[model samples]
Target: MDQSCDRTRNSLSQSPTPPLVGVETGPASEFTGKYMVLLRDGEMKEGLQAIKRVASLTSVCVAADYEGAAVRMDEAGKAEVFVLDKLGVAVVSADPPQLRRLQSAAAEGGAILAVEPERIMYAIEPARDRLAILDYLRGYRDAVNRLYDSLTGVPGEAEKELAALTAFTDNAEFTWGVQATRVNQSRFSGRGVRVAVLDTGFDLDHPDFVGRPVVSHSFVHVQTIEDVHDHGTHCIGTALGAQQLAGGVRRYGCAFGGDIYVGKVLSNQGSGADSAILAGINWAITNSCRVISMSLGARVQPGGAFSSIYENVAQRALTSNPGALIIAAAGNDSNRPIVIAPVSRPANCPSILAVAALDSNLGIARFSNGGINPNGGGVDVAGQGVSVFSSVPDSFPAWDQPGGPGRPWPPRYHTISGTSMATPHVAGIAAMWLEARGAGTTAQGLWQLLTGSAVRLLLPSRDVGAGLVQGPV
Candidate 1:
C-alpha cells in the first residue's frame, strides 16, 4: 500500500465518488466556490500533472517543492489549503527545519504553516479512520492509579493524574478583573463582536444566548446547528454567554454582547475528520468570523501539519478582518508526564491561540496540553475547565433521555468538563480586546496583549506557557 494512503483505513466511505469539492448537501447553486477534486495522496503529483494536459483551463499555476508549495499555498490572494497529518492531528515532532522555524515564530506572530519533513510526510493525507479510536481512548481519561498504555490515536494522561483542574466558580470576582484588564476604558456593550464556534453545533435556544443570531454551517454529514453535543455548545457559551455561574455574582463574559458564528465542523459524536475540519476552517475564513472558538482536536498528527492552509487563512484574516481571533482547546485527559495532543491543522498553526485548562485555584488542568519543550513538544496556556457550565442540545444524554435508538429527536443544553470548556474564556477576551482597540490590530499585536494580560501560573515542572488566560492589556 502507498505510505500516503497508509495513514488510516477508514470505516466510513463516501458514495457518489465523493465530489472533489462542492457543498456536501443540496444543490451546487448554494455556493459559487470553485471545486477541485483533490486526488488522494500519491495522486496529488499525478493529478497536477494530468491537469497540465488541459490547455483550455488557462488560469492555472503549479508548484514544485516545499518552497513552491509554501509560495503557491495561495499567493496570499486565494483560498488556503491546511493539511492535517497522517496521525489525524497537528504534527508533534520538530525535526524538520521548516516546521521548527514555523513553531519558533509562533510565539511572535501568526504566519508560517507546515513543519518537519523527515519525521513527517509533508505531502501527507488527512487521516480520519483514527478519530474513532482516539475519542474512545478518552473514556479511560479519568481513571486514577492506572498507568495507561499510550494508544495510537489518543493523548497522554500524565497531566490529569498529576493534578486537579478548575475554572471560575462564580462570576463576581472575575468580571471586574475582566473589565479592568482589557476594557477599563470601554463602557459600551460588546454587541458587535463576532465569535465563531467551530466545534459541534450550539444550543440555539439556551437562555444565556437566546437572541445571539447563530449563523452556522455543517460539514459533518447532513447534521445542522440544531444537532446537540456537549463539547461545541460548552465552548460557545463560555466565550460570549451573557452571564455565567462562576465565582458568584452574575458575571458578564468578556464579550457579553458579541454576535456568534456556529461552525459545526465536528459531529454529535464529539469527534470529526480532518477533511471536514479543513472545510469548516475555510468556511470560517471566507465568512469572516473574527473570533472562532474551536474546542476540539485530534489525538494524533504529524509535526508541523497544515502549514499552507493556516498561513494563507491567517494572512487573510489578519490583513482583511484584522483583530480576528482563533481560540482552540488544548485537550482533556491530563495529569501526567505526557500531555494530550492537539487538533489537526490548528495545533501547529502559528496564528492560533491554543488554550489548556485550569482549576479554580488557577493551576493547570491535569488533562490540559502544555507548551513545547526546548527539545520539541507542545506548549499551551491554561484556562478554567472543570465542571464548566454551557448550553447543550435538547437531546443531550446527561440532560435528555433517548426516546429510542435511531429515533428522531431535537438537541438541548447541558454542562460538561474538558479543555474544550476552557477555550471560550480566552476567545471572549480576544473579542473584548478587538472591541477596545476600536481600530483593527495586527495578529502580533493581539497576541502580545493576550499573552501580556494573562495571569501567570506554574505547571508541568517546565513552566510550559505564560499563565492563566485573561483579557488583553
Candidate 2:
C-alpha cells in the first residue's frame, strides 16, 4: 500500500467498535474483529465459564466494578472493545453522569465500547471483531470518517487563553437577591436551558462555565471563532456563571451556571453591523438556541429602514418556530442628533426586548439612551450595569499589553462601563425567567413576560419601559 493508505489503515487499527459499538446500521458481527463478555451474573466463576464456552481466548481482565478501567483505557488511547456486565446491579444502575463522562472520554479518543445493560451477552455474544474495529476507527483518522467537525483544528488542541475563576466569600454588602440567580436558586437553576448569547465571546476555559460546554463561532471578517472581545463572555458570565465554585469563590459573574453557547457576531473593534448580527441570529435559531442576548449595536443605520441588518434579522428571527428571544442594548449614547435607534427598529420589532442600562442603585444609567420614541409602546426594562465586574479578553482595549506590540497573552482582567454591561443582566434574568415558565414557554413569551413583569422604575415610562426587573415573582 502507498504511504497515505498505510497511514489511514494505521489510524483505524486503534478503534473500539466491538463489531456493533456505534450507531446500529446493520448486524454487529459483519463488524467486530474480536469481542469479550463482561458477565452480569453474581457468580464470577460462572461468568468466566460462560466466556470460556463462548470463546477460544485464554486470558481475561475483570471489568472494573464501575467500568473505571474501561473509561480510563479509552481516555489513555488503549482498550478497544469492552463487555460490560449487564446483570450486575451497580453496572445496570450505573450513574448516568459517570457513564456520560466515559462516553465523552471515548468520543475524545475515537474508541469506546459499551454493552447494553445486562445485554452484553446479547449484543456481542454473536460477533466481536467487527465491533472492535469500529470502536478503534471511531477515534482514529480513516477514509471512512467524514463529518462537519473542523479538519484544520487539531483534536484536543488548546486555545490562546485559559480562563480561571477566582472565588471570593460574599461580603454581606454584595448580596441582594440578584435578578437571575435569586430566581434560579428559588426555582430554575437553568436545569437544561440552553442560553446562546450572540454578543462577544465566552471564556471557554473558565471553571464555573466548564460544565456547560461552549460552542463558539465568529462571524465578522476580521475575527475567528475564538473571538475574545470579552463582550460576549461577560454577558455569559452574568447569565450562567457558576456560583460557589468548589473550594473557592468569584465575587461577581456567572448566573449560577448552566449551558452557554457563544455566537460571536461583533468584530474585534467591538462593532457589528446588521449582516453579522443577522448571521449570528440565524445561526443561533438554527442551533435551536432558546435565549439569545445581543449587547452590541451600531450607530449608523444610514441604509434604508430595513437596511438596518440588526432590525431586519430581529424581525425575521421572530418568525421561526418556538422562535428565539432577541435582547439588545438600547445604546449608551444619551438623547442627541440620534440618541439611539427607537425600540421599533430592533427591540421595537415583533419579539425583541430593547434594554436600557441601570445602576446597582436601581436608576437609569446616566449615559443610557433616552429622549422619547415618537412612535411606540414603553421603551424597555433595566438591570445592574454600573461598576459591574466581568471577563476581559486578551485583546479587549481595556487591557494593557507587553511583548506583541499592543496585543498581549495571559490577560489581566479589568472592568469597564457601558450599557453593554447592563444588557447581560437583563438577558440572564430572562433566561432564568424561561426556566421558571417550564418547557411550555417559547422565546416570544419570555420577552413579553419580561416586559410585563418589569417593576417600572421612576424614569418616564418611555425611558425605562415596564421598569426595573425584579427576581422572578
lDDT of 1 by residue, 318-365 (tens): 545363566665444333446444333344355666666554445554
Q: Model 1 segments beyond 4 Å from truth?
A: 1-168, 171-189, 244-252, 301-323, 337-345, 373-377, 398-413, 460-464
For each candidate, give its TM-score against the true structure: 0.58, 0.55
lDDT of 1 at 33: 25
**Native-referenced Cα lDDT, model 1:** 0.46
- In model 2, where do residues sit more than 4 Å from their true spots? 1-185, 246-251, 300-312, 335-345, 348-350, 376-378, 394-413
Worst 10 residues of 2 by lDDT: 1-10
lDDT of 1 at 218: 66
Q: Give residue 257's error in model 2 in angstroms.
A: 4.0
**Candidate 2 residue lDDT tens string, 301-338:** 22212122233345445554566777766554443223
RMSD of each: 14.0, 24.5
